[model samples]
Target: MGKKRVIQQTEEELIQETTEIEQKLQGDVKVAKSGLREGRIYIKSTYNNTIMTLTDDKGNTIAWVSAGKIGFKGTKKGTPFAASKVAEALSAAIEKVKVSKVMIYVQGVGTGRDTALRTLAAKNIDIIGIKDITPIRHGGCRPPKVRRV
Candidate 1:
């Protein structure tokens, strides 16, 4: 291994980067304010990770967060705790954008779904409704093949 190297950004570059980030954030807030106070939140909890997405009523995505992106590693990302944390962070983003009412659609067959929903409910935002959108096999899988002779 070699010595650690640090990349430095000039003052103007740093300022530009900050401005770009702020502009993006401003764009989110504007979308939230576009004649609809209600936003949609989709929480997908898979066995490996939990992901939450915030979208406008027209299905345009405003932002999204995931458990792994929150610094949890390996199997921990699938834990209920990580899901709740993801929910917490998403709720904060909702608050930032002043989304007063949220309609939640939860999917996936993971342990984090319920906990994440509970965490979102515990927040100050007003929940319009909660719906489970996970798909189910209508009549279960096809019967197994006949046992070998």
Candidate 2:
């Protein structure tokens, strides 16, 4: 029986790797604004998670935040409180872009949906419109057979 040996890096190679990483990090530090005004907010709230995305009027996404993205874990990510935090974080990004009004398109039957909208309002962002895009069951999909006893 023998133990396997691991590969070791030379000092120069290690220095090169570190410098590359630093350069990549610096490249990612740009400001958020892209010279746009009015935008749309898309909210998808599910039983287990809430995701909010901000996009320009042309539907190009500018920024996004989710309950899980804001550090909520497991079941807590679906709560209204977590949703509010996600909205708050996103509002700051939106404000930086000077977006005064937003047309919110919300799709879901989750508890966080309304709370997120309220948080945005409290942040002083104008609510141009709120549209519910939740899909309705028009007798969707065939149901599975009843379970046998």
Q: Report per-prediction Cα RMSD to one decimal.
A: 8.5, 9.5
Q: List the residue pairs that clash in candidate 2.
A: none
Candidate 2: list runs displaced more than 4 Å.
Answer: 1-32, 147-149
Top candidate on TM-score is: 2
lDDT over C-alpha atoms for residue 46 of model 2: 94
Lowest lDDT sum, 10 consecutive residues, model 2, at: 22-31
Off by over 4 Å in 1: 1-36, 140-144
**Model 1: per-residue Cα lDDT at residue 99:** 83
Clashes of 1: 0
Q: What lDDT tens digits, residue by residue, belong to model 1 across residues 33-86?
A: 434588999999999999999898898887788877666668978999889878
Judge candidate 2 against the unseen true structure and give its global Cα lDDT, from 0 to 1. Answer: 0.80
